[model samples]
Target chain A: EAGVAQSPRYKIIEKRQSVAFWCNPISGHATLYWYQQILGQGPKLLIQFQNNGVVDDSQLPKDRFSAERLKGVDSTLKIQPAKLEDSAVYLCASSYLAGGPNEQYFGPGTRLTVT
Target chain B: GESVGLHLPTLSVQEGDNSIINCAYSNSASDYFIWYKQESGKGPQFIIDIRSNMDKRQGQRVTVLLNKTVKHLSLQIAATQPGDSAVYFCAENPHDDKIIFGKGTRLHILP
Candidate 1:
């Protein structure tokens, strides 16, 4: 079985520029998630999608960040006017279920470097 | 504001010895706990998990212990190898809620 897939394993953008990351979840997975991992810190949940609907995005900065899952399969996360603090790895994960001790399989992640 | 956190930032264990990593969570409502191993430049890989109803769960030389009284979680690796060197993360989730991850503990296997 193939795992979660993400694009542009690495990205670099100037401050105030916009950047986007793409993700394709595992086949038949019902839940998808996006997380940000800063240096020396654990990955923080940014948003979660159960099928085509959002399950949670309370931690996401709405002023700069946004994400969407289309057709309950592919998802995209975007950051506008990126700040230096936005330099971190963006990870995408997918699970077979929406809840209950589900094992989420993660992708390699897209490393974003905002200069 | 409740979050999961590791007891230590880094732990160095001699190869072939047993390794233990500790974590503490603030949310009592969290019922499911999971441990993930993150290698350099790679995303977190699931190690094992234990439910609130379970005090201990073992899988392939790895064990997870959950102490509900203190809200503490621990991961134990037997006969640690160099391949086991990586950051270990503990995550918690309430029933049908989002999973929250802890800072992580970097495990260094020493020769």
Candidate 2:
């Protein structure tokens, strides 16, 4: 009955620094996703996981961004050598099924600022 | 190369009035659509959804209309309140799996 949970609602880092965000999804949910929302834009899918296996990560910046969903319950998204363009809100969401029309429950996103 | 986009970037409406937000999608294969509301500091929350088979669906205070012909989607909010002030986004799922979100429409309710 608890919704998805995320840590460090806000974060600030200098360019070239590294930052990581954590997410704990709702119980029994099998699909977890990470998205980036720039100011005045919609959330863009960064990665998606289904029970510890990556379902999709076509938009993820492989050179600078990485994510893992170990044990299939919690997830962590990391960005190394952050750039000014990386300053955006990172949102986490979970759904009950891996492939369905089920609604996704989102967590309070982590707002990251790179100086 | 499918994308979802909104017709309006922002909409202003008087409180107690109704609001209609429109979106267009390029993927004709999309079978599912959803509307989400996001506050200033929070992530998007699900408002309502409509499947491609159905032309319309209604919730407590929200209604979603889908037109497969023109690939158009719309959300109607009845008796809009101050709480309805937020950014609304429409997402499309081509295969009923992965979803693509629109840029979003900022809704401002004037009291």
Candidate 3:
């Protein structure tokens, strides 16, 4: 079984620039999540999607951050006019669609650095 | 505003010894708790999990203990090896849906 996959394991950009990260979740998993992990901190949930529908995105910076799960299998998170404070590891995870305790499988995150 | 937090920021243990990482959670409504291990350059890896109804659950070389009364949780690793060195985080799902993660505890194995 393949785990969640992410692209561009690392990225560096100047302040005010734009950056995006891609994620491919495990097959048959209906729940996909994106998280941001700052140095020395645990991953923070940025957004969650359940079968192409936004489940929760309360922590997402609406002014600068946006994400989409078009076909429900893959997702992309974008940050426009990125700021230095946005430097963090963007992680993606997936889990089965049950209601009970769902064990999430994470992908190798994309480390973003804004200069 | 943190629903979960680690008691220790970092812990160093001698290899082959057991290691216990502690965590305190605040949400009494939380029904499920989980522990995750993360390496330096990777995302968090699921270690062990225990539901609110269970006091303890064991895996191959790991165990998760949950104390609902005190809202406390702990992860135990037996015969810790070098490969076990990483940051461990504890998360909880209040409604069995969304999860909140705690600031991790760095576990260092001294060979």
Candidate 4:
């Protein structure tokens, strides 16, 4: 089976510029997640969606970062007026279920660099 | 504020030897734990997982051991190969349904 898919494996933008990343989760998976992984650090959960509705986004920076899972199959994460601190790899993952010990399959991720 | 952290930032082991990565979590309410392997330029890949009720779980050449009393979790890779060299992260599922991740340990395979 195919795993989660992400677009634009790498991106570069100037500070204060806007950038967006896209994710296509595995088929039939109910839970989709977006995470930001800084260099030498683990991925931090940015937002989670169960189908078309959001499940959690407490860590998301409301002032600049936003995400949406419109059809429940694909999602997009956007950062407006990106900053140098926002330089990190953005990962997308999917799981069969939301809660419990279900395993998650991750995409290749998009590496964003802000100049 | 519950958090997960690793005991060591980096570990080096000779090829063909076993490797063990340790992690400590502060949330006693966490019910599930998972180990993930992440290579350079790639996202984390699930290696093994264990539930709160179970102390251990094994898959292929990897094993996950959980100690609820100490709030510790470990991943053991037997007969490690060069391909096993990667950053390993421990994650926990708490009551809030969030999967919190540790900073991760970089495993280096020495030839």
Candidate 5:
């Protein structure tokens, strides 16, 4: 079976500019997540979606970042007026279920470089 | 807030040697713990996981030991190989739902 898919393996943008990333989860997976991985640090959860509804987004910067999973399938994450600190790799993962210890399959990730 | 942390930032060992990486979690409520290996430019891949009900779990050449008493966790690799060189991360899920990842430890295997 195919793994989770993400677009624009790499991106470079200037501060205050807008950037968006896309993710297509594994077939039949019921849970999807977005994470930000800064250099030398582990990936941090930004948002989580179970089907088309959000499950958690407490860490997300509502003022600058937003994400949506439309039709309970593909999803998108956007960071507007990007800041230099936003330069990090964005990862997308999917799981077979919404809970439990089920393994999450991750994509290659989109490396965002904000100047 | 929930957080997972590693005891070491890096570990180096010779081929055929056993390697152990350690981690600690702050949340006592976390019932599930997982280990992931990440290679350069690649995303993290799951290695193994353990639940609060179990103290130890083994998979392939890897073993995960969880000590809920002290809130410590460990991953042991037997007869480490060159392919094992990568960053290993430990994550905790307090409610078996959302996951929180540790800083990770970079493992280096010498020929």
Candidate 6:
């Protein structure tokens, strides 16, 4: 079976510029997640989507970050007016909710370098 | 604001030796615990997971031990290989609730 897929394995943008990352989850997966992983730190969940509806986004910075799970299959995460601190890897994950919450499968991730 | 943390930032072990990585979680409500392996320039890969109801779970050569009383989680790798060199992360979750990840522990294998 294919795993979670993410686009633009690497990205670089100037400070204040806008950048976006795309993700396509595994087939038949019901839950999708976006996470940000800074150097030397674990990935932090930026948002979660159950189908097309958001399950959690409390950690999302609404002022500069936005994400959408269009039709609940493909998802996009955008960062506007990016800051230097935004330089990190953006990871996408998905899981099937069979029986109960299952282990998440992650994509290669998009490395965002804000100069 | 993450409440989970690793006991050590790094661990170096000789190849073929056993390695143990430790994590401490503060949320008692978390019902599920997981361990992930992340290599350079890649996302975290799921290793193994254990539920709160179970104290131990084994997968391949990896074993996860969960202690509810102290909220401690540990991952034991037997006969570690060079490919096992990577950052290990522990995470906790309570179903739909927020999942918290620990800082991470970098495992280095000495040749």
Runs in model 6 lying further than 4 Å from the true structure: A98-100
Angstrom error of the Cα, residue B51, model 1: value is 0.8
The number of residue pairs in model 1 that clash at the backbone is: 0
True contacts kept of 4: 0.70
Between candidates 1 and 6, the DockQ winner? 1
The residue ranges of model 3 lying beyond 4 angstroms of the native Cα positions read: A98-100
Please write out the lDDT profile of model 5 over residues A1-115, one tens digit for every residue. Answer: 9999999899999999999999999999989999999988899999999999999999999999999998888999999989999999999999989767688999999999998
Lowest lDDT 10-residue stretch of candidate 5 chain A = A96-105
For A1-115, candidate 3 gives per-residue lDDT tens digits of 9989999899999999999999999999999999999999888999999999998899999999999999989999999999999999999999987455689999999999999
DockQ (C-alpha) of model 2?
0.80
Model 4 per-residue lDDT tens digits across residues B25-80? 99998998889999987889988888899999889999899999999999999999
User: Between prediction 3 and prediction 5, which has the larger DockQ?
Assistant: 5
Comparing 1 and 2 by TM-score, which wins? 2
Share of native C-alpha contacts between chains A and B (below 8 angstroms) recovered by candidate 5: 0.72
Q: In candidate 2, which residue pairs clash?
A: none
How far in Å is the alpha carbon of A61 misplaced in model 1? 1.1
Task: Give the alpha carbon lDDT tens digit for every residue of A22-103 in model 1.
Answer: 9999999999999999989889989999999998898899999999987889999999989999999999999998766688
How would you encode candidate 2's per-residue C-alpha lDDT over B7-30 as one tens digit per residue?
999999999999999999999989
All candidates in order of lDDT, best leading: 2, 5, 1, 3, 4, 6
- Cα distance off (Å), candidate 3, residue A13: 0.3
Assess candidate 3 and give its TM-score to the true structure.
0.97
Over the stretch B1-111, how does candidate 1's per-residue lDDT look in tens digits? Answer: 779999899999999999999999999999999999999989999999898999999999999999999999999999999999999999998768577899999999999
Share of true Cα-Cα contacts across chains kept by each model = 0.72, 0.78, 0.74, 0.70, 0.72, 0.63
lDDT of 5 by residue, B47-78 (tens): 99999999999999999999999999999999
Model 3, CA-based lDDT: 0.93
- Give the Cα lDDT of each candidate: 0.94, 0.95, 0.93, 0.93, 0.94, 0.91
Residue-level lDDT for B97 in candidate 6: 41
Candidate 4 backbone collisions, by pair: none
RMSD of each predicted structure? 1.1, 0.9, 1.0, 1.1, 1.0, 1.6
